[model samples]
Target: MTNRLTKTLLALAVAFAMPAVSFAQDTCSNRGDLDEQYCDDNHDLTADTPTDPKKLKTPNTLVFTFTPVEDPAVYDKIFKPFTDYLSQCTAKKVVFFQVQSNAAEIEAMRSGRLHVGGFSPGPTNFAVNIAGAVPFAVIGDANGYQGYTLNVIVRKDSAIQTMEDLKGKKVAHTAPSSNSGHMAPVALFPALGVTPDKDYKVLFSGKHDQSILGVNSGDYDAAAVASDVFDRMVERGVISADNFRVIWSSEKFPTQDFAYAHDLEPNFRDKMLQCFYDYRFTDELKKAFAGADRFYPINYKKDFEMVRFVARSAGESFNRAAYDKQNAGKK
Candidate 1:
């Protein structure tokens, strides 16, 4: 089978693995949108650790994954140094698990095959609610967490000079769960007089690189993508900035979040967090991640409020049903 078909089939398989769940917790009065397996007795919008010692896990081997926005192999190499540090710091065998899609990453964590991961802004909500992810840090410099923007790009020769000009044109969105590629457009595009699905049909390219390449090859008239990904593409000479015109840009949004599964043994979890916060990135690593030198601390409920708001505005809840719908129709 072609790679595209394989990817679609894999996504569908993972989607089916996400069983139906009810968020109601008899113990917590306000569990918010968390899955039934989790509780938020403290009112924090995150999963609470299992109170029972038998339910907590302290594995000899720790599995790590990064958001599958780009090539997982590329990230596997990029994160090797940190994984080595993690192994030594935590005194365990650390392995990098290269997941092919956001759904697969979330499922790996949910099944305990993954111990910790870096989830993209849009999928972080899904990870938290459905996979018991507890976001604690994001890549940033000393100032704070780094941020990226949503950019709508079209070929310079294309007639689409404004967002309104995109009507009736083929547009590319990375994935339905992507913040810049999909959700942001659904929430913000109508204001610019170009509505997705109504004004034009969205083409799912699966990844930002695919969307960028699609627009460059004339497969798409325009694409909504993350600025950081666009910048990296330009830096890597995969595409030229002068060849593309950015018609619209949104306010800065926080970059991907690094979170751990909430069911880890408390002492092990604390040591792992410290290991992440203490390490400094190499120069190459910093350059690869837009100058982010360290994993700066953050609170998910506060740092991700804007992302959650955008999801809500688009009539989305990061629950199992949403995940299933997002993956079931993958193109």
Candidate 2:
């Protein structure tokens, strides 16, 4: 591991060891992989809304955020139109919370500071299991939900040309909880004749953009990154597709999930969901999201089945223990 990464892991260990905020303990027949504070009474594999009416929230202002896939300032501007529409639609003050990392975003919601936000696929499982985040929508259009592939990228001039060539090289994985960036690659790469930690020491780049940039700058030999993020970088002229070659690519995986805190009042939650489902993306929003034009509805239990499968295949879990271990370096 890099010196920076070693220091980061140490910091994470300390941060994750802190006690979680206390909630009244209630017995549930099946909690599944959720934290002890949450219950999965319906067996949906997500936190259920609080049974006690007093526990439900009807906040005056709604705080929103997007996944920290790239520069927060860029997304704050790109999502301005949608946030405005959400405020008008829900008749509430909406504020965009610029979270620095996946761990911060999840904690904000878990503490009831964040009302709704978009979560990347891998961290979405963590958010659901530990933060009471209920995913309800994804970026898509008439055809179906938008998806992305795992692209193992190397600079066009690099000596690394195949999966086998990655042995003994520095390979970047965005974060421990990232799907395409880490988990999926772990589950799928071995069949390609390379094992992540065994064949090559894995390095955490913290985000897909960073991984792509690292590979381009020779900071790492290659990187496993989400295709959509790579495409977005190319579209914005941040990098040229011609400059990098994808040595390997996996099948398409689901994109980020737009989720809300499970404790929101039912009527208020339904109204807010309607706002998301009804609003059409502006031209700029469409352009930023790779042609996706709307928040396509989804179910966590059904839609995330494949994501869960990959996590399991990779010997990963989204329970509290796993969350604490994996997310420490994310922030």
- Tens-digit per-residue lDDT, 140-208, candidate 2: 998999999999999999988899999999999998898888999899999999999999999999999
* Residue-by-residue lDDT tens digits, candidate 1, 252-296: 999989999999999999999999999999876787788789999
Clashing pairs in 1: none
- How far does residue 43 in candidate 1 sit from its true spot (Å)? 1.3
Off by over 4 Å in 1: 1-26, 329-331
Candidate number with greatest lDDT: 2
Candidates' RMSD to native: 10.6, 10.7
Local error of candidate 1 at residue 288 (angstroms): 0.8
Worst 10 residues of 1 by lDDT: 18-27
Enumerate clash totals for all models, in the order shown. 0, 0
> Model 1, residue 151: displacement in angstroms?
0.3
Give the Å shift of residue 215 in candidate 1. Answer: 0.8
